[model samples]
Target: MNDQPILLILMIAVGLYTFNLWREDCKNAQAGKPSPSALPGATPASAKACIIAALGALVILIAETWGELRLGLSDQQSKITVLFGIYTLIAAFIEELIFRGFIVIENKGRALRWAGVAMASVLFAALHPFLWKWEDGVFAWTFSAKGWFSTAAVFASSLWFYTVRFASFNPHRSLLPCIVAHATKNMGVILIKGAQGFVVGLF
Candidate 1:
């Protein structure tokens, strides 16, 4: 256990969240629709959504990995990256499928989907050790007031955008947006950190 306690715990939290969502996915599949692995053919609307999501992800990755803000492979840093990456990918897929796809479908109205997003955004903040970096993170956990303002900022902004993006298109099509937002958020953080380091190096 050479890793940081907070980071480790957060990783576990993400795992639990993802696992719970995966189980729900299994239940959804039992009904009729296919799972993420065997998702049916993409409709024209969904295909477009996917392309937009892919492009956004690409832009974020490029900004981080290519710019002066690139990350280093220090032991602790690498560990955090690997754990976060794995969790992010898993959580994004699971969370999106449940919150956006399944819940929206089962609820029969906007109420359920809105509730899901609210719940997801709140939970998403809790799962973060550095919640202060998002938007609503401040309201999620009070004991740790560290960077709470910043975290809240990101959460609100991201959620606002996420809601709008999801509303503009169908879940079958908007799944990509959620996936992209998750990936892009990770990449965006990395880029900011990288840029900071680059600036520091020049000082």
Candidate 2:
């Protein structure tokens, strides 16, 4: 689980995706395309907005479902925080770079926008898998389309839609909520593990 190969792959993917998205904009600006910045608003840059977003995120924290997904405590219980901590930190930044920074900001087309969302969903779920036993070799279903699709759906609804970038659909113009929402969600899970003893593992 601590292998560097996956991390290296992630790094390469992010760089390639960003270059693909922004290269056209770069070339176009050189030619004559209009320039428009597309960075999302993070917390603190907007005090009131940040507070409101944080509050909203707290609401999501209360509703988080990941804790329920855990069955019981294992040796991994104590280290749950470490695993999710890295997951939250790395995923928060990397996913943003891939989705909003590159995909949405670059294309802004409806179809491409959804494609970006779908791509992010798949990647995110692939990172987090359900419980596995050592003797099984590989969870046969893990490589199946149904398995991937279900996990992707869960990831999309929870992490992407219910948590991050709700504005991608409608009714939301602010990005602060997304950031705060993610933070609160991660923190809430941490609290649950401490208080009630729900544990998550990394394969």
Candidate 3:
């Protein structure tokens, strides 16, 4: 089954949503009520923070890739395309906005913030559909150890993303570092997929 069309449509929708988020941020900034904890933060992104967050995510990704390989799970084999790669990059920002920005409850204390991160991470991991898949209008449940491992990794990555946002390095709680970290993890996946000859074409 070719899912290219569906992917394209979803990408367009997601792009629009991202644009809207940016616009809202702009408006907030102009109103002198900048949402430092949200998208389009008023403060400039720190290059050092970007590097630290990206490296942190990259480390997690490497471990996940290794585990998948050891488990003989080639999930991306013959499944990726250039279009998908592009979508992944766009989706990285979108996901970060949703999971790390909007979903997170702000102005909370340290414990509450970490609790929110934990809850968001769980939801993020569950949304990845590793233990189940919807196909042909039917939702099927099929569990694999590899799938579980991947889900766990995603959960861990989400924690890292939230940590990056709340960490002292991101004093203003800017989303830039989170975005970079997410992108690094996603691009790493694309690179690994391509290296394994899983990326077929542009689609």
Candidate 4:
């Protein structure tokens, strides 16, 4: 079975989920009870935070991909560059909405919020199917060393995004920083992989 269709369906699902969040926020605003954390507009401080988060994410991506860069590249080109790009952006937005926007925003008090963050981070990591492999059209759990490492890396990345989502001291919470950071990380990975492909082609 081709994984591309599965990925496309997942992307659409995520997009719909994000759209529902936006719709709900709009409805709440029209009802004269605006949500404080309703995807607030980015302020100057948030913009700075976004830059910081993006840089941090980029550093992480570089570190993680360094081995891949050093290794001999594959001559085969990526067929899903455009699909992957769109998917990454949509996935990042969906993750922010589910983990940071809904979970963190709905939970009250510091303790609850932190708990929510932890739960969401774990869920976020687990939801990433890329860490595992599918065999004979069935999902398989190898629990290999690489799988564990990938899952851990994903968990850490999710935690970083969550931190950025609520890093602002402002009253309103903006997910812009987290989204920017996530997108930066994804783009960095894509660029590195593309470079690897180019290097391989030269061989």
Best by lDDT: 3
Compared with the true structure, the alpha-carbon lDDT of candidate 2 equals: 0.47
Candidate 2 worst ten-residue window by lDDT: 67-76
Which ranges in model 1 have alpha carbons more than 4 Å from their true place? 1-47, 51-91, 94-105, 131-146, 157-165, 171-174, 198-203
lDDT of 2 at 89: 44
TM-score of model number 1: 0.47
TM-score of 2: 0.47
What TM-score fits each model? 0.47, 0.47, 0.85, 0.69
Q: Model 3, which residues run further than 4 Å from truth?
A: 9-42, 75-78
For all candidates in order, the CA lDDT equals 0.49, 0.47, 0.80, 0.65
Query: Across residues 1-203, which tens digit of lDDT does each residue of candidate 3 receive?
Result: 22565766588577768757765785676577877754644344579999999999999998888878888876633376777787877788888877877888777787887888899899999998788888878999868786788789999999999999889998867777888999899999899988888878776
The residue pairs in collision within model 4 are none
Q: Which wins on lDDT, candidate 2 or candidate 4?
A: 4
Per-residue CA lDDT of candidate 2, range 41-97, in tens? 221123544455556556544433443244222223333534444555445444554
Residue range 1-203, candidate 1, lDDT tens digits: 22344665576586677556555554565566646663321122355565566555555445434432233322112223434444555555555555444544333577876676677666655555544233333444334333353345445544643553555554444355555556555655555455444212211
By summed lDDT, the worst window of 10 consecutive residues in model 4 runs over 71-80
Candidate 4 lDDT, 1-203, residue by residue in tens: 12465667677676968656776775676577877876543222345777888987987776655533454323222334445555666777777766766666454787787787788888888887645566777887656544555567678888788777676542345666777888788777667666565312211
- C-alpha lDDT (0 to 100) for residue 114 of candidate 4: 74
RMSD of each: 9.2, 8.3, 3.2, 5.7
Candidate 4 wrongly placed segments (more than 4 Å): 1-45, 67-81, 105-107, 135-137, 169-171, 198-203
Q: Where's the lowest-lDDT run of ten residues in candidate 3?
A: 36-45
Model 4 per-residue lDDT at 43: 26
